[model samples]
Target: MKSSRQLSKIVNIFLHIIALVFTYFLLQGGSLIIESLPNRHTQTQLEDYLDKAQLDALDKSLDASNLEAETLSFNQQSVKTELKGLKDVLAIQQQNYKEMLASRYVTEDNQSNRQVEQIRQKIEQGRVAITEVTQKSNQLKQQLLQNQQTRNQIQQEIQDLKGEARKVLRQEQRSNTLKAFLIRLLFVLPLMAIAVFLFKRFRDSSYWPFVYGWGYFSLYAFFIELVPYFPSYGGYVRSIVGIVACFLVGRFLIHKLQDYLEKKREMEQRDEESRRSSLQNNERNLENSFEKIHKGICPSCDRKFVSPDNKYCVYCGLCIKRECQTCNTLQVSFNQFCFECGEPHREVQENEHSEEHAAEPNDGINSSPPTPSGV
Candidate 1:
């Protein structure tokens, strides 16, 4: 068993080196070749979005520059005309009041003077209001310029961020490519290679546990690593591979079920020896079971077995080699033991003794009668 383990280790190492070389040159390079065929949809869409963003940003910046120049100009023509009208009214009213003072009654002259003062104060208030509006308009123009600069800065920052994001995404993709390659080398390739090795060259080897376990792991790792890198076509390799795998598995199960049913139907018609060989109930089946030898099938349960040392069947826990009770020699069947000495195992010896006893009865009376006749 130790020697068998050593052999399994050797095979595992040899196969691993082959697998590593195969994955590095074959699978990794193949993936790169597949990548070169065409850009995926997401990548194309991303590039389109970036191009659109640049064009849009350029157009908006040009529009903002034009608007920024226009925002500083405030029309003061209307305010100046109104102020001039107020000034003419005030000057004309003062000349009328002076003419009235020269040729009117005393009370009328006093009233005219008060009216002139009121008109002058109203004209001054109108001038102050116009001045306040001009100051507020100037302040608003400055704020607009600041806002325009802010918008432009924001647009530039957005473009910069997008560029940075694209760079990061490219870096991430390169890192992931290498990561997937390494994962295949460390996980997928070795499992697949060992599985192929066991299924081909080491089918009957004693390290069945590794063979069976590694086979399952190979299939599992293939999927875990494969689904992430599915190609661009809709439902392409993934769907096709899934359908094929399911079909093969379903066909295999159907055949196995049919074979089992046929064997069962024939079991009723078979003779005792035939039934014993076909059935698992008899002890002789420990060696003489006539089922097919699969990759790592158990003799008792007829299932896939994972026995590393081949001493015990993994499915049914049946001992592959029974120890001889008489001489402790290891053998397969209960029918034979210790071929060197021809000694039966304890269980077989009991049966033999019982058969011998049953063939003859106690003969004490017959023994005495025979002795007398001889005399």
Candidate 2:
């Protein structure tokens, strides 16, 4: 279980790392595509085309001048009067050609110059455009680079976040697992120890509750891991259910153990009480036997063991009572009172004199029965 848990944690870390790497590459690939867009080459091609156009215009201008020079160089003037009209016609034609050439050349030059100027302007505009494009591209590149750097930083931060989150999660999981383990150990180990103690002390089966509690707590551990998969309210429901389940199971086991212990204690109490009662009964029986051996007459109870030869209880006092032998009803031997009857010696003497006098009078007149002995 320990190894599997460790492996699972390692695997989770690996997966997070892979996810971060994948995200980084995706961002980089997008930046590269943006940087490689086709606008720069297109602008360069337009500049090249304008250069060719300017060159073609200059060539056409040179070709027109060569044709005009050839036409002028072929003119010959002679034959004075006859040649005059030919010369005038040739001159007119030549002038017309010169005018045509000049007009054409001027038109061509003007057009070429205008075209060259336009091309120059275009070139200038193109340069500015290229500079703007370059600036924009550079800015974009810089932005992309910065974005990449930021992405890298963010990726690092994300990695750190994931690491921290995973660490915290793992730590929490470990804590929970450790707590579960400790709870199980606390529940099971102590019960097992108790079972062993009971077996040693009372020699009975008492480990069943521990087994049941272990099974229940193990199930609780598994159920806790499932809490995140459920809906929001499901956690509360599961928590309540778990609490109730734990409570029921714990209560049941504890109640059973308590009941078992109570029964055992009751049995012990009953055994102790019965043993005490038996001892008391034996003592009572022994006392009865001794009474029987003495012919149902304990002199101590009958006040018949008062003798000068005994000092403590011989039958009960195991000694002689120091009293007058004539007074068999136990008399006081010390001071003025009888120890057995709580009567003063002077009162007993007075009663005896009164009895003697009453008995003498009774002799003269239907004497009252002799007063009961010891009155």
Candidate 3:
């Protein structure tokens, strides 16, 4: 292919050479045409001048012969004098004709010389123009050759760039594959180990199947890297298989991790509940001890009790009320069932005792009053 291209280029160069040769011939032919054009015009003008000079000379000779005839016919002295004057006129006319002829020759020679000079100048100008054109053509050809060389260099550079790019791309692809493999090993391998450990702990042998499947997937990934020349569709198929395998393995690992965490959380929760229950029991025991130390008597029943001044009596339904001994004022009991006096229920006992003593001395004074019957 390269040789053929070189041959084609050689053929094109030969064709350009042929074209330049043809152009040189064309320019030469044009110079010839320019040179002949002025000569042809000068020749026409010279012929016309010669014909007019001949006709003028012939007319002058005829006029001189007529003057001589008039002289021969005259016999008088005056006529003879007139005939001499006519001969003088004929001589002047001949002299004037000779002067005109000389002037015409000089004028024609001057015009012919000018025309030749013009033709020569035109030829020189044509040569100059041809030289300038040839110079321009040479410059153009040089520029074209330089441009062709530049284009060839650029094409070579492009090809080199493409080759370098392909090399870099291949290197990058390999680097990426290696990096991916390392990353997968760093993450998936540890995860697989953890899965295996958990599987042993849980005694679930079924997890081994997924481990084997992941091993197969790793092998497949390795194989995919090995056969890099495969078509895009083939690579796509391998990628799909690898993805599905990785997904399945990942799902299994996640499920195992979830189960492990769930079990751990359940155990921790049970321990936490047990600790909470123990704390609650300890709090309840402390509360009981505090209650025993701060016991007060229930005043409603007038009984000797551990919880004196208790608002609700365990033995009786009556609310405790105490009366002042000095003013007989009724007050809610809080100070050992009586807020009015330091004496514990002394006023309420005394009032009830007097009434009860009047009724029956044997009954120890009724500290509480009985409900009145509606009569």
Candidate 4:
């Protein structure tokens, strides 16, 4: 009989686990459907909302200005290079004229004088050429400076256009995010409602495994899928939601505890026969009572045992042990069959046990209680 009870418990656990596995698969399928229902937004698609025409025009203008500045800079460099070469040539010509003037041979003095005058005229012309080249270099430098200023202005305009475009893109992204959140909320709310109904209506029914499985799935969906999408608003919204959930759950638990106490008080007021009959008919309640008895507590009153070997509960007067009629062996009162002789035991009524307890002090005993109806 003990082995049979153990087997039933194992089977019950296996069925509950199977129910949860199937429920997980259902949640996966539902999540896929919900995700497909929304018109999802992509980063690139939102960017398309910004008007980029002005930005593009500014970019082109910046590029053209950079190119013009580079050309002007190159021209300035070439003019400076030419000016350096002209100055080198003028220096060589002036050095040759000085060497000739320092020569003192009289016969070639007159010829040397005429050569020196020609050299002086050539040096003056070279000086005029250097001045012209220097002026050209200066003009190139001015043009390059103007080009640099224009490029700077273009760059500044491009920066302003880009900043405006970024603002528009951000607005579009926020709007799309809100839409996605609403779509998901619509899908999950109905599921949560149905789950709540099943929990309240059928949680204790025979098909409780499936009911509990759906309840677990709904809780996961609400906390994982739906709650996280709520607009955080610096965590204020989530905080408020958490507080409300705590209050509702606390209220429910308090009410349930009060109801349990009320029911227990009502049960204690009944006669011993009715109380025993109610416990015997309920397999779950009977099983729980047997478990508590094993722990040395009164099954009916839930009080700790003051002594280890008491035949009846001192606090509640509930029978805890008895002697089998067939084998005359002492055993638990709740057991239906005698462990020693394999003989089925008869039900010992509360009145009979009470009489036996008063008549016999220690060695006397009675038959065991009846089996639970379900068992």
Candidate 5:
């Protein structure tokens, strides 16, 4: 019997495990279905919320300014190169004129003087060219500085615009997140409602495994899927949700406990015969009775026995044990046969009932002595 009980327990455990596995697959499938719902919020890009035309125009202006700056930079480089070449040419011309003046061919001939004048003229022309090139370089530097300042201002404006656009994007994203959360909630709420109805009405039905599986899925969907998306006012929302759930569950348990106590009290008020008859007619299965008996409790009233050998329940007066008439051996009263004599106890009980009926006097008001047939 103990081995049988153990086997039953093992089978019950496997049923629960199978139920959990079934719930796992159901949750997986449900998650896939929930995920299939279109999410427009997640597809949103930052650029989607920005003023595209304004940004594009700004970018174009910035690019054009950069191109112009590059051209100016190249021109500056050319100016520097030209100035260097002019300076080199001026130095060579001065050296050549100095050498010609110191040469023995410098006798004051008219041709020599003419050549000296021509050298002076060439030196003056080179100085004027150098001055003009220097002026051009200075102007280029000024223009480059202005261009740099303009680019800096434009970049700052672009950054400011982008910053504002980012703020708007974040706001929109948060709003969209709320909308999406509501949509998912709407989708899941009906499922949770159905699961709750099934749990309340049919959880103990024959298809309890499926009901439990659905209950687990609904709980997971609500707690895991929906709760995280709850708009948190510094966690107040989640706390409130938790408190409400706890209160509901606690209230249900309290009510169930009250109902059980009330029913027990009503049952205890019944007469012994009625109580015994009720027990025989509505008794739990042998397995439950054995468990209660093992725990030293009266199977009829569910009250603890004063001693293991007690013949009847002290509270309910339901028979627990009695001696067999055939073998004078004590055994459980509910058993149909005695262990020692293998005598059927029901026969003895029937004989005893017959004898009690025989001993009772007639009390009916309409009773009369019967006349002899000859009279």
Candidate 6:
């Protein structure tokens, strides 16, 4: 029966261990899935797309500006040089026409007249070329300004799109965090509740070992799998729990130690009082102790002898040796079995044996006598 009870305890412990391991993995696996995908793929991609768009817009703005700058720079270099050269040629041609006009007046010949007319036509053509060059330069500069304005507008649109993307990304992140927390909580809450119930109700029962096992699994699951994924301050929560546990355990141990000490002190005082009383009965107690070492049962009081005898226990008395009924060999009176005969014997209590001995006299007076004695 005892072995069966022990076996059941073992089975209970084993099952508890199995359950704890199963719960650990179940929670850990679920948490792993949640933690691995804390953010949604679509939301992440959208945010990235927005960021890229902003950069692309800025790049396009820069490219367009660079092209316009190069065009303007080239126009400035070519137009200024061409306009200067044209102005110089026009001045020289005008001077040549004036000289031709003055020389024609002095000569008054058909050849001089034709030269003057040709010079005047060349001067007019040069003036027209300068006017056309200045107008073309102005047109190119105006086109550069328009491109600059267009680039600024495109850049502003890019900024607006990027801001929208940031806003959406923040919202998505918040939603995902909530979902993950709920997922972890869903698995943790029920297991934790069951563990607490078992600890409280079955902790001292035949299934007590299971309580410890469940407790260990519950703690590991909460700290390792559940708390880390809590909304915030995971570390603080773990630290506070540990501190409280340690404090409670320390306090319990201290209380137990104090109680034990108090109980021990009270027992010691009682023992001291008993020792003093026995000392007052010293002479009688000494004689009982001496006889108990040899007799095996108390002769002074006919009570059971105390053991470890060099005449010491408080129950020391005249130790009587009882004879084995089967072998007629004396043996220890307090023992229920004979050593030599290997026979079982009844153990008689001191008070009951005394009562039986007192009844023997009454039985003697009530007995019938022999016939000769009666005559």
Task: Pick the TM-score winner.
Answer: 4
The order of the candidates by TM-score, greatest first, is: 4, 5, 6, 1, 3, 2
lDDT of each: 0.55, 0.43, 0.45, 0.73, 0.77, 0.62
Q: How accurate is candidate 5 locally (lDDT)?
A: 0.77
Summarize candidate 2's per-residue lDDT along 283-354 as a digit string, tens digits.
343344334224533222233344434333343332122443344454322223555555565324544665
The TM-score of predicted model 3 comes to 0.27
**Runs with alpha carbons beyond 4 Å of true place in candidate 2:** 1-111, 197-375
lDDT of each residue in 1-375, candidate 1, tens digit only: 122356766976766565455544554555564454332332422354355666567767767765664654433344445556655665676666566656556566676776666756665675666567666656666676776787677667667757876886776555555455554546556667878888777654665544555565566556645445554245676689689989999998999999986765555444433332344344335334523233455444556556534645544444444455566565543334567568765435544665789767543432211111112
Q: 1 or 3: which has the higher lDDT?
A: 1
Q: Residues 185-304, candidate 3, lDDT per residue (tens digit)?
A: 453455456545654564333333343444343343344322332223437856876799899999999999988767545533443223222222343433332243245433222334
Candidates in order, TM-scores: namely 0.39, 0.26, 0.27, 0.71, 0.60, 0.44
Off by over 4 Å in 4: 1-14, 21-25, 39-46, 94-108, 114-129, 246-281, 293-330, 341-375
Candidate 4: which pairs clash? none
Model 1, global lDDT: 0.55
For candidate 6, the per-residue lDDT at 79 reads 92
Please state the error at residue 286 of candidate 5 in Å. Answer: 5.4
**Which model is ahead, 3 or 4, in terms of TM-score?**
4
Quick one: how many clashes does candidate 6 have?
Answer: 8
TM-score of candidate 6 relative to the true fold: 0.44
**lDDT agreement of model 6 with the native:** 0.62
Show model 5 residue runs off by greater than 4 Å.
1-41, 97-112, 193-202, 232-375
Listed per candidate, the RMSD to the true structure in angstroms reads: 13.7, 35.1, 43.5, 6.9, 10.1, 15.9
Q: lDDT by residue for model 6 over 1-375, one digit each (tens)?
A: 012356765876676777676667655775576556443332355546476755776877778787877888798779989999999999999888888888878888888887777878888889899999999878877877877787777777777787788788777766766676677677667768988899878876665555666677667767766665655453675578678979999998999998976754553344322332232244344444345445654433334545544232244222234466677676544344678877764332323454778655432221212111111
Q: Which 10 successive residues of model 2 have the least lDDT summed? A: 362-371
